[model samples]
Target: MREQYMRTGDGFLIVYSVTDKASFEHVDRFHQLILRVKDRESFPMILVANKVDLMHLRKITREQGKEMATKHNNHRTSGSSPSPVLWGAITPYHHMLSKCHYLIYHLTKRLCELLSTTCYFRAHKIPYIETSAKDPPLNVDKAFHDLVRVIRQQIPEKSQKKKKKTKWRGDRATGTHKLQCVIL
Candidate 1:
């Protein structure tokens, strides 16, 4: 059933939880499935790493998520294929006043986030952003806006395949393309 939707889809938003390794893993699998179903090596896709607010419980590194995207995209960043959708690879941190929430104090976490962005910009070349509901640098809305823009741009170009022209029983090729009104 999902395959059916994929077949007709103009673009895809593949999301995973930043805190869950399993969700990140599933993003990889889904990427493969989409390629198989659509039979295209590349398409307009956005990979979102959500739930960054749960920093303490993060099981997947930012690098891992970006690496997975680079792998699935076959390392080709541009040309002919539709532009990649803007992605949100978020990193959330806690404030002293927000003691009611859990927090992760690993020094490398922020470094990893910065490294992932740098890698993507320097090598992978995909539009990447970071979004967190409970943190700064939030971009959840921007991710969706980018998705809509990409889909609109790609869908029209992809559907440019020449459509077959059909004629009705009383139709004439030389006549106006618009249907003629008939009165009894």
Candidate 2:
């Protein structure tokens, strides 16, 4: 699955439920597989801890999730210069509202760490939003829009830099000719 995604060159948003220890472990393994892919730079990753509505059943605490994200971000950032803030964790609205402020706090702390360590996201200050697939007030659309906005901002900057570097040497001659023509 990781290879397939890498071949397509599409950024990935990975969603996993944290209801039990088994699922949490599964997420860890998946994360490792993603990291093993050679062209991981082409693949931006967002880790979503879904079903936060079932906080009572949460086998993995917010701190654990943040720790995993931090480790993953650190590894990815260390390998690449100006590492993009491609690492983040999101929670559902139910958890956000049910007196689980710890979730937000931990996520914020992790974001701060990533910003401090990674140049790409630090400059942009990537957004963190809460969402719920189940509730209207939570507004999954807004969360996704925020993600899209960040991606749009980064991808274009990368492409623009590449475009500038690839400009034809003849462009200067053309510009000179146009100026002479105008003067004549």
Candidate with the greatest lDDT versus the true structure: 1
**Which residue segments of model 2 deviate by more than 4 Å?**
35-38, 63-131, 137-139, 165-184
Q: Between which residue pairs do clashes occur in model 1? A: none
lDDT of 1 by residue, 27-139 (tens): 44455677788797666666555555566876655665456456544221111101111122111112211321122221112212223333443442334333454534355
lDDT value, residue 176 of candidate 2: 46
TM for every model, in the order presented, reads: 0.48, 0.46
> How many residue pairs clash in all the candidates, one count each?
0, 0
Could you give me the TM-score of model 1 versus the true structure?
0.48
C-alpha RMSD (angstroms) for model 2:
12.5
Candidate 2 residue lDDT tens string, 65-132? 44444544421110111111122222333332342333323322122221121233232222322233
Q: Per-residue error at 178 for model 1, in Å?
A: 24
